[model samples]
Target: MTDTQQQSPQARATARIIAPVRHGLTQAGALAVLAGLIWPAQAACIAWVISGWAAGDTALGRTALGAGLFALGGLLRAALDARAGALLFEAADRTIARERAALIEREIRAPGPESSAAVAALAVQKLPMLQPWITRYHVAMTRTRVLPLVFLVLAFSQSWAVGLVLLVAGPLIPLFMALVGMAAEQASRRQLDEIGGMNDMLMDRLSALLDLRLLGAADRAAQDFRDRAEALRDRTMAVLRIAFLSSTVLELFAALGVAMVAVFVGFSLLGEIGFGTWGGQMTLAQGLFLLLIAPEYFQPLRDLAAAWHDRAAGISVVAELDALDAADRVALIGTGAATAPLDGPLSVDLHGAAALPGRAVPLPSLQLRAGEALALTGPSGVGKTTTLAAVAGLVPLAEGRVMVCGQPLDADTADAWRARLAWLPQVPHFPDVTLADFLDPRGTGADPWAALDLVQARHIVDRLPDGLETRLGESGGGVSGGEARRLMLARAVASGGDLILADEPTADLDSETAAQIVAALTGLRDQGRTLLVATHDPALAKALDREIAL
Candidate 1:
């Protein structure tokens, strides 16, 4: 089997995402483990100085040498730790930046914004949790793997009794930590899921704030938020409890190990016990060295226990990344890049096209020449919007091809073809830009006033706080649905494209407003702009030259 296939699922996923950024990780982990190894030498220096004093051989130079060695080891260990931390954090920063950029870049051109909130949560909050895992947990694990064994060897060399106590206790700490880590991983996974759900709820609620207020459901929305908050709080607390429990278990075993070692070393030095030692005797130096080494033997275990939760959380986050990366969704074609308009006559043809993933819905072959106004009239769920998007190059086809401007549409031609099209979607969306910019989104130098006048939306802009300078967004900035439709028509007029695609533009508008929208669209046809409208409104469809009902 390949390396990743041999590992557990979470570990496989975690390693796949993290291994790419692990350039200096090995060196960093080596540095951290080396820092831990320094303690044994420092402990030796202390033991030497104490042994000299106990034997009445405390010459000034010998004592100074021991003190100097201890100080130098401390400084060297500190430097190693600091360098390792810098490398690890740098790697962590790179990893987060790379993942966040990839997620945003992939989602920006999607046909639907349905998962934007959850993706935002993943980008902003969940992805950063991997940082501590890379920086702390891995280093701790490396030290645990090496330092305990080194200390065990040193302890056995001095006295087997002390080594025996550590040998029994160290294994149990890791065994218990392994068990606790399972629960930790489960809790962390739930917490991450809760966080995504929370963001999704908040975004959905904010988008429908106006409707909720009008429907007298604001209190109900507030209650929903409170409930989600409570659930998140519970999930967070569950993780914290598991972390605290693991630490408590580690400390209990660590204390017992150290205590047993201390008692054995102390009694051996006092001549109360002699059988546990190799020489049947213990000197002050040996007793002191073993005592100093006792706590240090469990040091790596302590560090590992402390960072076990981070490993769990990091694995959960990586699994999340894997899920998002593997998820198969219907995304738009093209780089969504700005391009010069495709150079061709305005024409559209669909050859047995169907929406992505499957071809259950039949989209028959059709042809439309320049300056034609065709309506795709159909009931809901008849793939009207899908056909419009397919023609616009915003949705990919599974079984057939779309020709735009006499060119077969693919990634190579989608952006350029889209440059020549104007899409006025069912629910109007505006960026947080000035009204003038929104009117001329492509910066075609088209007169905003003229476009507004053509659509009869000039009166709507006159009521705005800043006229053409006013900023608005998807909520329409207090503009009603009909007004928003008129404004979008104005934008389409300003964009100065050859083909206009209007989707349910008058679906919820009143009779007068719908009539005005229909008039503006017919006016566009009079201007020789080809119109492909997806609509259920009979009057608007009848106004066009021909209709194709799906």
Candidate 2:
């Protein structure tokens, strides 16, 4: 076994993906071995009946007993095989569910830049490939190791010549398989990446359909989609061709091995070959039994060869998931902090705080008293947002200390500090739910209408036929930009936090709406909230208690 920590992502993923199904695999392997053991008995019974018939023994009772034993052994083997298949499929379902859950959870916790569309695609599309790998391929792999040896031992006990033929052919099968499998692995990885790219392209085009139509580029976009689809189909055919060739090669060797064993057994029974059966001539019954067991020896190897494609696809999926899990972007602080409501306003102090060392923005140190309002104004792209993000602990700090509520900000205290704050981002994300649900998903909070009224955005709810019950699309679809801003402001007002952070709150609004937003900010200040606003609006800045230029 390889050291787990030192293993590559594909290796690590294989280990974890198998852990949930380990017990099931063990049980299945046991059943398979039991079935293999039963096969030799069945073969022996068939040979005994055939030999008795050839000798012209008219003993009906002995023949009947041999036939009955053959039937019983065959039935037992079939039952074991069926039960093992059931166990493996059930385990496979559970394993897929567990892995998907982990991938989604990891993506949810990932930093903003690290959580891309590829992550979602891998979780939904790529991860399911592991199902076949576990259920069929992995089961076949275990049987290939166990059953072939059992058959070989039985064959050797009956006739060593047959055993030697199997031993020679079996090693050749894997050697050829290995050569084919290397090419298959590379093709499988490429195919997976191409499919992922296709998914992303389709998603992007669908999301931008309206824009493309308006710009008269819809025809070009459709052509691109067709081209990508064709390429994916071509790649898929390549993978299939390799898989079929591998199966064909294994089948050829297996047939050759079986043929050689059969010819050797026939010659030995005729006394033409004299070197295979414990230094004595082989009897017809023993020769027939060895012939019957020869094919069984090579069956496991053939099954494994058939499942090689699944192994390639599964390892590729694992590598993709590992890449998603390995993202190292800076994440939010205070995610695990205890929640405690603030009694009053919060005081924030940033000492020599700067943007992350290599970033473009370098923020200056600043201090604010409890219940104070400060506006951050500068030319565009001058670290205005970066300053607010650093203060909010949304980004990593490289050269300064942030003291909040008289305590230095660290992971332990970050959550508690964030609980007392409400942030209004430049771009808001809204799920597909009722307007009421957008305001409070739990449906138990301060009246959403009252918050909208304070922001002068009550007209938005009134205009909708469903009022607060009106459903929005993703990213607040069906709402205008100004309306979206007001909705976010309404949310912050309803949050009842002691600190409010607003970014460009009135950027696209008319003078009337901008004044209403300013009034809302003034209202928050009067309510003992410490406010930080990053903006370029002179009117909004003049209304604040203090101004800081980056």
Candidate 3:
């Protein structure tokens, strides 16, 4: 199956759409308010039925009608409570979504070589696990633990004898659920971690498919995936086993609590015990009322075991996501603090730039006059790209700074400083639109043919069916090596007129084409535009007024 198809159903359900909604009220507060409202409504029905029936003038038919209306009100209250529970569930889901978006953005903007694999795992694998837990577990915990206690207290205000037994037995449901479900929580947490790790490993193997095939290691990769899949299956089964046992245990106790209440009522009716001795003795309807409401109070207990299990899994995910966000915040600040601005003479200072992450090789300082052409000579992978990155303000520098036009530039907002400087990297990215649209962000009329001609790329454009109007095919997907490089140079020159930083601008072209491109570049130099070219070709390096070696 494709990766998208392989995504767990749980992940799809909780897929983050936007920022998460914040948690507004504590579970305790909500339970208190809900239970308070329920108490009055429940009590009013009891008094209405009992008091009306006590009057001798009330007919049997009238009593039954009054009872049915009271039951109808109870049904409406039940529906209202369900709606309130759903509102809280959606709020919790929103909160989780917002948190995930913020974390993902932080990770993307982070500096240097920070791997986002761990962060992605938490967002995709762990965040979904928390969704159901947030909704269902929260509801269960409140209804099982807090609502029962609130009802028991209100029951006491009506009748002390009936209230006493409720107070004693109500707590047993939660106590038993907790004791039995403890192991389930631990198991679910372990299973969740295993699932996240497996997800990471699977993604890694897939991304490295080309490398594994080239190195003849496909079998090893397959075996590794198989082992991880087996481990995930084992851990998942362990979690399910514990979950089933805990749920079964909690259900048994809930049923037993109901049975105990029934026994007390039966004995009280027979007068085997005093009315106040065991539980209150009253009419069949009164006894039936307490019996009916007792199980409803603890109904949330039946799901307690599963709720705790899910909660443990969810906490594990939130903790991991928070850590990733913390790390990203640190990286963003670290990149901003390492800008070093170099000084030049009386004219425009073409100061050197350095990016964060260590310099792979030494880059000598550069100073240039308005008319001078400087060449940076180095083999591949020597700090040449790093130098360009520093100048562009993309990477954080370990040491040194870039000063331009005789003024020290702010390293933090390098792009603002670069607005006047032309830059062409080894590989440049362009949009999917036509060449003219790519060059003009503000929709200014730009002659694509003229720009390509200046960069010696006119013939390539003319050969296309649409010429200047032809699309670059999204980040230059269909362009040949030489065409992409030359088009990049055209973009930089078209975009900015002053200083140009060209990395291997002529490396992929024919000798005649290279010469023509060099001639065009020299015209810019003669026109007082400063140029810095990182090249290994001795012929091209020697063509410059000055050269620097790594």
The numbered model that scores best in TM-score is 1
- Give the TM-score (vs. native) of candidate 3: 0.60
- lDDT by residue (tens digit), candidate 2, 1-550: 6387589755786687877678998898788878878988888888888899899975989789998998899899899999999998898888888888876665444353332566676777778888888877777878888888988888888778788888889888878887898789789889889888888898888867867998999999999999999999999999999998889888999999999998998888888999987778999999889888888888878877877778888888887766655555555566644477533347888875454423435786789876789999987767888877777777667667888888877787777777777889877667777778778633465578877877778988898888888887666777787788888888887776678899989886798878878888888788777889999899999999999988
The window of 10 residues in a row where model 2 has the poorest summed lDDT is: 107-116
What shift in Å separates residue 38 of candidate 2 from its native position after superposition? 1.8
lDDT of all predictions, in order shown?
Answer: 0.86, 0.80, 0.63
Q: Which stretches of candidate 1 lie over 4 Å from their true place?
A: 1-7, 21-23, 53-60, 108-114, 269-271, 335-340, 346-391, 397-403, 406-412, 421-550
Question: Candidate 3: worst 10 consecutive residues by lDDT?
Answer: 16-25
Q: Model 2 RMSD to the real structure?
A: 6.6
On lDDT, the leading prediction is: 1
**Clashes per model (N, Cα, C within 3 A):** 0, 1, 14
Q: Candidate 2 clashing pairs? A: 334-415
Q: Name the Cα RMSD for model 3.
A: 9.8
What shift in Å separates residue 147 of candidate 3 from its native position after superposition?
2.2
| Residue 317 displacement (Å), model 3 | 2.8
Per-residue alpha-carbon lDDT of candidate 1 for residues 1-550, written as tens digits (9 for 90 to 100): 8776578866685566558866678789899888988998999999999999989997999899999999999999999999999999999888889888887877766523336789889889998998888888878888888999999999999888788888998899989999999999999999999999999999989877878998999999999999999999999999999999889889999999988888887787788886787885888888888889889889888888878888889889888876676666667788888999999787888976566543446675678888899999877778888788778887777777888778899989999998888889888888988898889888766679998988888899999889989887667977888899899888887888888989998987899989989999999899898998999999999999999999
Clashes of 1: 0
